[model samples]
Target: MTLVIKPLRKAVLPVAGLGTRFLPATKAMPKEMLPVVDRPLIQYAIDEARAAGIEEFCLITGRGKDSLIDYFDVAFELETTLRERNKLDALEALGPTSIEAGALSAVRQQEPLGLGHAIWCARSFIGDDPFAILLPDDVVKSDVPCLKQLVDVYNQTGGNVLAVTEVPREHTNRYGILKTGEDDGRLVEVKGLVEKPKPEDAPSNLSIIGRYILTADVMPHLSKLERGAGGEVQLTDAMAKVIGHAPFHGLRYEGRRFDCGNKVGYLEAQIAFSIDRPDLGDAVRAFLKNYTG
Candidate 1:
């Protein structure tokens, strides 16, 4: 018998939205730059990818999103100034966050197309290997990184895998819902996927999250996919085409998911992360007590 180990080395981050909901803050900064605690939102996504053993990063960006690319670049002048000021700890913090040269690349989405288009822009970067996709808006806090959990499943299945969670029946319209064929603990065999289907029409309550391990074969479907629901080409629609052709499975992630795309979710993430931090837990607890009082 021969053993095979598939290579999962690259991750694509789609970050080209206008972020209109965030208003003035997003007017000057990319939404991904908004801080969850002390670290920016994009940092959390990148950290998760690094934890998953992904070596290369591909960011699909749009106009005025240069700051996101700069965030991961080495700041020689800033490092020098911090070094001179004896801020060695801060300097070291920046070191681990820096993506190695040639390890990170960016492709412009040009238009505010959609998730599918943003991912399609990275076709060259993805080449012929399987790649991971991380949506920074969905910040997952867990002992094991969310993508890493899915990667472990991919190692066993050797096919496309997506992160899935059960949402309320009423909320099925709010996400890409999966139609399941079979369940084996955490892995659910995907029969089909419906994008934001009505509660009555939804195939199953299993809602798809933002993390995915996609095969390169998906490129063709994304390129030719018709715009569905909201006049935009949805990634779900593209993935749906490859369902039975390839072994598509969904992994139910073990963690709390904060949908940082909305104001309420973002605020909740701040409170949740703050309560988890030992340095600020006491003060944060007291503040919450007084706030509730």
Candidate 2:
């Protein structure tokens, strides 16, 4: 039997968290809007989705996330000024920020539930099609966009494909660890999922990151709204319910994922990303060397 894979086009970004981690700063601004370098963290996620050929985007947002929606809107006054001043370079830099009308939409998650609840809010936008979920808080730097890497696997497997990375066994409690069935180094068969399992109880060191390509069927499980780990609706728990029923697998993607939700991780991302850029790399590297010296 041939498995038909629906073209993965729609993507959901759940940006509803209050970002209490970066309090005072994030007290007003959505964490997704926090700048990694010159551009906001959310821009990197959107760029990754677009690179993977996602056509429609749904931002599952909450309070104080209005800025996220406004970021993509046309700044007529700003653009007019740039054109009048012949600031072509400045105007061109803003090109990618524009989202075509109707191409983007947002839904509100009124409460601070868990990741599963935030995703469930996007069911209406997702309908019956497969979609990708990207967490802005997790930024990945790679030769190929992380989501595109998973999409490649999804095209071949015709099931759910999630991005996984190996973490220290002792730190397994920090993430959703995977139970394995088969492994080929790059792609591992997902036997089961355990959210934030204790190091001793963790089945494997491989942990699921923020990138995911899931089938529409998982939405039904999320609709059940059963709270799991942390007394919140965990997405891993919902995905677990559909494990044996569908072809679920994890892809060990090629990239460095920074946990922007953590202060140290956010600082690391800034340095790493800045040093990776052609224009900023040399200057940033020199500054680092001199500062440390």
lDDT of each: 0.92, 0.94
Q: Write the per-residue lDDT of candidate 1 for residues 144-252, one digit (tens) a residue.
A: 9999999998898877999999999999989999999999878899999999999999999999999999998889988884798788889999999888877899999
Candidate 2 differs from the real structure by a C-alpha RMSD in angstroms, to one decimal, of 0.9
Error of 1 at 23 (Å): 0.6
- Stretch of 10 with least lDDT, candidate 2: 238-247
Question: Where does model 2 exceed 4 Å of error?
Answer: none
Residue 206 displacement (Å), model 1:
0.5
Task: Report how far residue 58 has shifted in candidate 1, in Å.
Answer: 0.6
lDDT of 2 by residue, 56-100 (tens): 999999877999999999999999999999999999989989999
> Which candidate gets the maximum lDDT versus the true structure?
2
